[model samples]
Target: MEFIYTNPIGLTDLEVLEVGTQACTPTMKFGPGVRDMYILHYIHSGHGTYSAKGSSVSVVPGGLFLVVPDTVHSYWADPDEPWHYTWFGFVGTMAARLCKQAGFTGSPPVRNPDPSVPVDPLFSEVLSLREEPAKELLLTGLLYRILGTLTVPDDIPPLQPDVGLHVRRAVSFINARYADPIALADIAAHVGLDPKYVCRLFQQRLSMSPYRYLTDVRMRKACRLLRSQLPGIAEIARSVGYADPLLFSRMFKRTIGLSPSAYREKAKLENTPSGT
Candidate 1:
C-alpha cells in the first residue's frame, strides 16, 4: 500500500516519517529505496511481517524494529490483524556511522522487544506523534535517544585504551566550551591524540563527526538564546562562537529553516501574555 502521509522533522540530515495504518490485504510491495541512516518502527498495535535482505520477521504490538539504510525491506500486516505502527526514518552522516558503531551492522534488522525485555518509554513517545511538527521533533528525539540506548550496552566488551573514556572527555570538553570557538584539534589535544585519530574514535563511538556534533551543540544553544529575551543576534552569535552575525544567521537559517529574527519573533509571540 502507498504511504498516505509522511512527516519529516528537523533538517535534511535527520527526518522522521510516522506511518499510520498497518493492514495489507493484498501483498504490498516496495521497490529499492535508499536505506536511511536509521529506520525506527514502533508497533503501537496490530501485527505484521517485515522483510529485508531476504529475511522476514514477525512484528507485534510493542515491537520496535530498526533498519539501517540501503537495505531492501518491506512489510505487510495480516489482513485480519492490520498493523498500526509509527515509523521514523532518519539519515544523517553521524546517525549512520553511529548505528554501525553500535554494532547494528549489515541488513538484518534489530528487534527491540524480543519477548524478554520490557518495552522502553521511548517507544511510546514515537507512536504518540501522529500529527505534524510535534510528531517530527518527537520522532527525531526518539531516534537520538534510541541510538544512545543501543550504542552503550552494559555488557559490551571493553575497548583498547578505553575508547569510551576519550569520547567522554571529548563530550565533556565540548559541553564546557561549546560557547567558545572550539575545534576538533582542541578536542583531540585534550585527549592527547592526533585530530584524525580523534575523528575516527568519535565516529566509532558517536556515529557522527566532531564538527557536526559541535554544530548541534551550538544550534541547541542558539535555540535557547532565541527563546530568551536578552540576547541580540550578534550577541547570540558570539555566545555560540560565531563572530559574524551574518554568517551565524546563514547557518541558523540553513539548520533551522528560519532566520534568527523570525524564530525569536515567533517564539516571543507564542510566549506573550494575551492581555499584554
Candidate 2:
C-alpha cells in the first residue's frame, strides 16, 4: 500500500497522526525508512502482520506495537482480511533516551496486548482525544501520561546519586529549552557526555528519553497557554515557540481536541466563580 507522511508542525516536540482504514487488501509495504524517533501503534481492531529486523509477528486487535528509531520494518494486512489501527509518531532526544531506559534498546518490535498492563486507560484517552477535539487540555495531558506508562518499566532498579544527578540535569535542560529548537547533541553537551552515551544514561535513569520528556513539557505549556485568557491564540502559539498560528491551531486540535481560542474560553468560564 502507498503511504504518505506529513510532519505536523507546532506539536511541541512530537508528531501524531490518526489513522483508520476499512481494510488492508493485497499487501502493503513500508519501505526502508529511519525515524530519528519512536513509533507507538495502538491496534484497535482487525489483524495484520509486521516484520522488522529479521523478526516478524502477527498482530491482532488490542495489540500495541512499539518501534524504536533506525529499525527496519514493514507491515501489511492479510489479502483477505485487512486491519484497522491508529499510530502516534514522535521524535525528540529525550523521548529516544527514554526508550533506552525502558529496556527498549534496538530491540525488535514488541507484540503483545497485555490487558493487565496499566496503559489501557491512557491509550483509550488518546483515541478519545482524536475523535473529540473539544478536549485538548485533557488530551495533551493523556499523551504525556501514555508516554510515561509505556516507557517506565516495573522491574528496573533505582539509580545511584551521581548517575541520578546527571539524569536530573539532563531533564532540567530539556524542560528549559524544549521550545527553543534545541538539539539532542546540545543537551548531551550540556550534560557533558556523548549524545549516544547520554541517551543510554537517560534511559537507565528515567525509563524514557530526555527528548520525549521535553516534548511533554512543551505540550503541557501549550495546553496551559491555550486555556489561558491572557493571550490570543496566535499570541499563545508564539509564546509556546510556534511560529505559525495555523500550524499551532492544527496541532492543538489534533493533540488536545479543541481550537485554542475555544479551549481558553471554556477554561476561563469554568474557572469563574459562581454568580460573579
Candidate 3:
C-alpha cells in the first residue's frame, strides 16, 4: 500500500512530507529522477539494488537507503526475490542537521544499523496516524524517533574530546545560556544529574567545575566583544553575563590579564593598516 499526504506543509523544525509501504513485484523499479526533499527507505524484507552518482549498491533486509534533494537515484527490486520497504519523505529547517547527525551524507546513502532492532514498526506507525487530528505533530515526533534510532547528535561527543554525555549536555547548556542568569543548578537540572555530580564530571573530564567553565565561556565571548569594540563596556559586560561594568572589568583583568579598554586598544593597534 502507498499513501501520500495532501498538504505536506512544514509545521515545525521537522515535518514529514509523505509516508507509505509497498511490496515490490519481481524486477520492480522506480526513479533515476530527482526530488526536492529527503526520502528515506527502510527495507523490511527481501533485497534490491540502489544506484546513485554512477554507483550501484545492493540493499537487503534490515538496510536503509536515502534519497537526498536534487540527487538522481534509482532502485529496483531483485528479479527473483523483490523487496518490501517502508519509507517517509520530509522537509524542514532541522532536516539537514538531523540527516547529518544520522550519518546520511549521500556518498553511500545507505545505513545498515544492527539488524536485531528493526525500524519497520516505526514507519508503520506513521501510516497508522494518517487520520488523526494531531497528525502533523504526531508525525513530527515519530520522525524524530525514527532518526533517533539511526543516531543522535552527541553519539560521539563532537564538541569536546573525551567528554561524556552528561558533561557534553552541561557544556552545551553553558554555551547556549552563558549570557543568562543561569547557574550550575540549572545546568544540572537540564541534564537531569545532581549538581555535585555535574561538578565532579566537569572537574574530572574538563579540568574545571561547571561554574568555572561557564565563566570561561562568558569571558571568551567578552573577549570577542571587546575586540570588536562595538558595544559599551556595560553592554559588553551584560552581554557576557555581568551586570556591573566594574565587576566585568575586574573579571576581565583576572581572566585575560588586561582591562577591557586596554584589550580593545591593543586589538585596534594590531588591526591597524600597515601604512595608514
Give the top-scoring candidate (lDDT).
3
Clashes in model 3: which pairs?
none
* The best candidate in terms of TM-score: 3
Give the least accurate 10-residue stretch of model 3, judged by summed lDDT. Answer: 4-13
How well is each residue in 1-276 modelled by candidate 3, as lDDT tens digits?
A: 566552433243566766778899996998887665688899888999999988888998888888876578889999899999988887643566677787776575887756655576787786678798878678778889988878745463344443466766677677778889898789989999889988887776655688876776677678768777699999999999988889989988887768999999998886687799
In TM-score terms, candidate 3 sits at: 0.53
TM-scores, all models, native as reference: 0.50, 0.50, 0.53
Q: Show the colliding residue pairs in model 1.
A: 22-83, 35-69, 35-70, 36-69, 94-208, 98-207
Residues 18-41 of candidate 1 have per-residue lDDT tens digits of 343343444453444434336666
lDDT string for model 2 (219-265, tens) is 55676565546777777777666778898788776655578777777
Sorted by lDDT (best first), the order is 3, 1, 2
Each prediction's whole-model lDDT (CA): 0.66, 0.61, 0.77
- Clash count list over all predictions: 6, 16, 0
Question: How many angstroms is residue 270 displaced in model 2 relative to the true structure, after the best TM-score fit?
Answer: 39
When sorted by TM-score, best at the front, the candidate numbers are 3, 1, 2
Q: Pairing residues by index, what is the TM-score of model 2?
A: 0.50
Minimal lDDT window, size 10, model 1: 1-10
